[model samples]
Every structure is written in C-alpha cells, then in structure tokens.
Target: MSAPQHPAHAQVPHVLAAEPPRSRPSSIEHELPKVGKIVFRVQGIPLEVTLEGLEKSFKSHFKRSNSQENTIDTGLSSLVPCCYGSGHQTALIQFQPQTPKRLESLAPGRCYDFEDPDFQCRITIDQDFMGSTQLYPTISNLRIEADVVAIPGINGHAYGSWTGASKQNRKTMWLRDFMRKDFHTCRTMIFGYHSALLEHYAHTMSDYTEDLLQEVTRARGNAEEMGRPIIFMGHSFGGILITHSIVKAWISKQPGRLCGSILNNFKGAIFFGTPHQGLQHLDELLEAVKKNQGRKALLESIKFGNRDLEDTLSAFKRYCQETKLEVVSIKESRETRKATKGELGELARNGELVMFVAVAFSELKLPENLETTAMAEGDHSSLIYEQGGYV
Candidate 1:
C-alpha cells in the first residue's frame, strides 16, 4: 500500500479552466406519507429538522451566561430590542404580554415563539405586505409563505375554507386543493407540516443565536429522547445567517458555550442558495451593508460568526471548531445560470457535505424549444412554495 489514496474530490485538478457540464433537472421530488398531516412519510428516515432563526437577535442581545458574575453588564441581552417585524410597523408587530412569543399585529393570537417537545419547530410566517400593491403577485394571499411557496399563512386543516368567504371562514387552504387532484400525483404529505423558515424577523441578533442554539439543543434533546437526525436548511439570507452563527458559536466562542454544549448533537446541514463566499447580488447586498454600517451595536450583539463569512466557512472545513454542522451545503445548478457552478462542484468534491443537484426554473425553454430545462438561475430560494417557481 503506497500512501493513502486521495478521494476523487481531493485528487482531481482544480480544473477551473473547464466550464461546468450542462445541468439536468433535479428529479428529486419532496413527498410525505399523509396528505396534510404532521406525520413523517418514512418512519425510519429521521424525526428532527430545524430551520434556524436569524443569526442576529435583539431581545436576547445582552443576556449572558458568564460564570465570573463579578462585574455589571457582564451578561445582558440587547441594549435595544430587535426590530423583529418591521419596527416601522408598530401596529403590525407586538410581543406577548408576559412571554417572548412575538405576535403579528394582524394576528395577535398567533404565537411566533412557542415551546413544545412534540415538534422541534413551530414556524409562523406573516407575509402581509402593507404597501397596497404586492411585488410578487403570483403568491397566494400576498401574505406570509413557508419556504417561499406562494400559499396563505392560514392556520390548521389543509382542506381549509378554499371556497369560503373571508373573516367569516378563515379555515380554507390552497395547497390542499392542489394536492387533492393534481396532474403530477405528488404526495400530499410533503406539504404536511409547514416549512421551518417562519422567522417573524423581530428578534435581536443574540436572541436569534440563542434560539437557534435552543433549536439545535431541542433537536438533540429530541434525538436523545427519541433518536433521529438533526438537520438544518436555509436559503439566501437565511443561509448566510446559519453559516455566520455556526462560526460565531463554535469557532469564535463568541455567544455561548456551543463548543462543548451543543456540538455533539449536530448531525448535518442542507443549504439551498446559501452564499458560502459572500453576496451574489453585490449591489443590493452592498446597499444593505452600507445602511448597516458602524453596527457596533449590532456587532456586539452577535456572539456567533468568525468575524465574517469567509473565516467561518474556512475554519469549519478545517475542523478547527465544533458546532451544529456535519454537512455544509447541498446546491442545485441550472444549466446556464450566470452564477458560479464550477466553484460549487469543487466544494462538493472535497469530502465535505456539498452535493450537486439539478433543477429547472421557470420552465423557460430556449430558442430550440427544448423539452427539459438546463439553463436556469438560483431557484433553491423558492423551492418550497405552493406556486412552485424558484424562491
């Protein structure tokens, strides 16, 4: 036996000169056992799943678990409360009278944060855009959508008041109709439990971190109690938040004691359009960053992330830290998308958890009127919507 053989991902040349092969459709379709129930399709598959909270939190911003307890301000949550909903929309968002559950102004009865051992996450999306006109009208309700699928944020009973009047009957659901008599014959169960990215967006950065850690911890606790896989999935901005939080928690040792506390329970991660490198839409991201300049206040709140994104990812790959991570990303490529594909392939080859998936976006056929789509953009952001376009 000569030296140990390197895996294909390691032995292959960088091959940056070659363009990525034309992508094929991501034939992987998501399904569930029951049509509209919270039961897992495959009993043995796994029970634990988490769509991480914001990497930034406000309420839990100043809270600390310092052991030295000798000084003031040694442990605090946040100096200022987080703008979870739109801080501007004072009317649309409000916290519970005596609880941390942030409720929407429209649906005060709905609880954004609740504790239950039965389910690891209870997502509540309030996609109510009050601008009078909606940007993406294709979505249903023009309200909160789970996983970017264009559906209403109605609670309970899939067969909801599909054809009923509003206010009088709010039990109707749109996806239930699609699953009942669809041409594709897709399983109705996949749409069973709601998607986990139900962040109301009013959490402080620290609160976000702590909540994610709690989710991870809850997943592990659930696993220990029931035994299952602890998985996390994020897209776009969510992807960034998850990545940053992992580094901050384990590698940098910023917020809490994640290195020893929660690392053991982590199974793996699955990210769709997460930017491991940085912002894809540099202009938009740059503007967002600029508006958030000198975020010393915000920066101090984040006890996770390795100073930045690149450092966090690199440190993770090197195993320099331990956190809620086993796999980093699972991405799909459209045939002719302008974004980088070759780089994604390289990461997949590395023995890391990156995998290559294919998908068709918009069903846009080129000049030849091809039957299958290869040319597409990053559609992972919108994979789970009811309308089923790219998120």
Candidate 2:
C-alpha cells in the first residue's frame, strides 16, 4: 500500500506540523456558564442582498420594537450563506449575550418580513446548530458502545443536511432522533464547516480535514475515550474529506497518539451519494463559479479526473484493505434539480434535472467481503434523510 500523495499544488496554506495536542481533563468535562448565544436559519433570502444589508435590516427591526430593553445586549455575531433548496438562498444568523426573555421573544419558527422599495422578502427562522460539534446525550441506562459522527457535504448544513420534513411537516434529524433506537448505546454527533459554493474566503480541503481531525480528537478527550470504537457517516464531498482524514490517521507513526488511536479504533464508514471517481457536472459548476467571480480553489481540487483525488482514493482503498474496515455505499436513484439562471437574475431550479453522481461513481470497487452497495429513493440532497433500504 502506497502512502497518500501531497503534491506541491495541494500543500496546506498554513503550517500544521508543529501543532501540539489539545488538552482536556476528562471525557465529561465541567460545563461552562451559558453565554446566551443563539443561532437561527433564515430561509428564502434574496441573492442580491449582502450580509451587511441583512444585518442592518435586523438591527433596524429591533430598534423599531416597542421594548428597547431587549435590544441592549443583543448583536449579530456572524452570518453565512447555506444551502436550503433550489431557486432561493438561505443564511445562518448568530446572536449573542441576549437574555432568556429575548430568546423567547425571537423564538424558533418565527417569521420576519423585510420590506423595502427595492427588496421585499419574507424569511422563516429556525434554530440552527450547524457549525458546532457536540455529542448527543446518551439514552439513560444505556452503556455506550461507540461514537457515530456525521459530516455534511458541499453547501450542506450540519443540521439541515441530515434533517428532513415528515408527513406532519416536522423536521427530523435521523441520526439523533432515530439511529439510537437500533444502536442504543452509540453516541451521535454532527460536524459542519463552510462549504458554500460562493464563499468569499473559503478554506482549502487540507484546512477542513485538519480542523475535523483536531476538533474530533478534542471532543473525544482522554485515552479511554480515544480508544473507544468509532464510525463515520459522510455525504457527498464529505466522504472525500473522511477518506483523507482516515488515511492521515492510518499513516501516523506515534504509538498511542490521538491520530493513530483514531485509526486503530475506526470501526466502519457509510457514504451517501459520494462521488468516489469525480463529479459529473464539475465543468458546469466551474463555469458558473467563473461567471459569478466566486472562489474556485475547492472546486478545482475535485474536478473530474483530478489526479490528486484519484491518488487519495487509491490510498484510502489500501488502508481499508489492510484494516479490513467495514464500508457501505448508498447511491441516489433519482435525478436532482440543477440550479440555473432565473428570469429575475437569481439562481433557480429550472435547469435540466440530472443524476449528479451515478451508481458506478458512488460505489467503490472494494472486495465484496469489505464493501456493500445499495440504492436509495431520493436525489443527492435528500438521500441523507431518506429512510431507504440501505440503512
């Protein structure tokens, strides 16, 4: 098995070689005082609106409220675009230092209407914990068996990516809400990062992989926690990131080190609609990014037939072979709607719908004993939430 290649063009932007291990006293660390931070998702935002404009609108609304006291210690912390659906844009808003009363005032499921001469839009607000990585509380009296971490793909939300609306229109996060019924003792977690298509300061693939490695290591602090068995579930491009991270852990030489422990305790992996070969619509997406003047570093790295990605896959296969890691690949059986130029100049889903990743590309050609392939009923985006036979 050959080691993974890191070509000159794919070098990390920052030096990470000398970084020391993060410290945590125990697995169950003491909880800190609440900072009164709240994050919400704003859906149906107009593409032309800037982050500054959105913040200003929120501030103006608060000022016009009758009770000015609620606005005293509250302020916008960050806003980033996220993928919700086709034909429209969405953003996540974070506010901090507000009282419990303020939180009740701006409750989840609340709707805000922003009206102006040029811009008029109604946005629905829902509580969001997209970028934070934390363990879900285990069921009482259930002895913990393993940790299952889920990572969302490109333009995917930590919460929304794995969530789907039920018949009653209630959002369901299957990993947290349903997985425990069967794997009763396994702790679940959702990992998120900035993978927006038009992000201005998008980090490199190496940067994201490093962040995942460090964050998860810190989350599972101490030797006992690190030695516990673990499984990873990744959707779309997230599967690629996991492959790289696992390969790094496999090659770590230091015995009893965190990275090596991750490799040692890695139990299995589940890939949802991942393009192990390459994305079919890479050219179209690249052209769109060029026309919009968005950053292209991340896209270029996953371009069709990219040599580096091919090498990474090769290395991952070798690791799996040596470790006999359990693997499952779930391919989308439906076509996904593509975003295209709209009549009002915003991206819409009027373009031709296509199967972005075919079954051949989604399923790896690993030995039959180690790999299993199945097809799911939904398109790429909904595959994560779909209760298909694959599960």
Highest lDDT: which candidate? 2
Model 1 TM-score is 0.34
Q: For model 2, how does the per-residue alpha-carbon lDDT over 42-88 read when each residue is reduced to its tens digit?
A: 66667777667766666555453445433322233223323221344
Candidate 1 lDDT, tens digit per residue, 1-391? 1211111011111121122222222321121111221100001101232111111121243223553211111111001111121221111111212112222232522323333233333323233221111111122233211111111111111112111222322211223322222211211111111211121223444454454554443323322322322233344334444555555566555443343344433344334434455432222112222334433223232223325544655655544222313342323442212222133321011122221223221211122211112222323322222121111
TM-score of each: 0.34, 0.66
Error of model 1, residue 65, in angstroms: 54
User: In order, what lDDT does every prediction score?
Assistant: 0.27, 0.61
lDDT of 1: 0.27
Q: Candidate 2: where is the Cα deviation over 4 Å?
A: 1-132, 252-256, 291-294, 341-348, 386-391
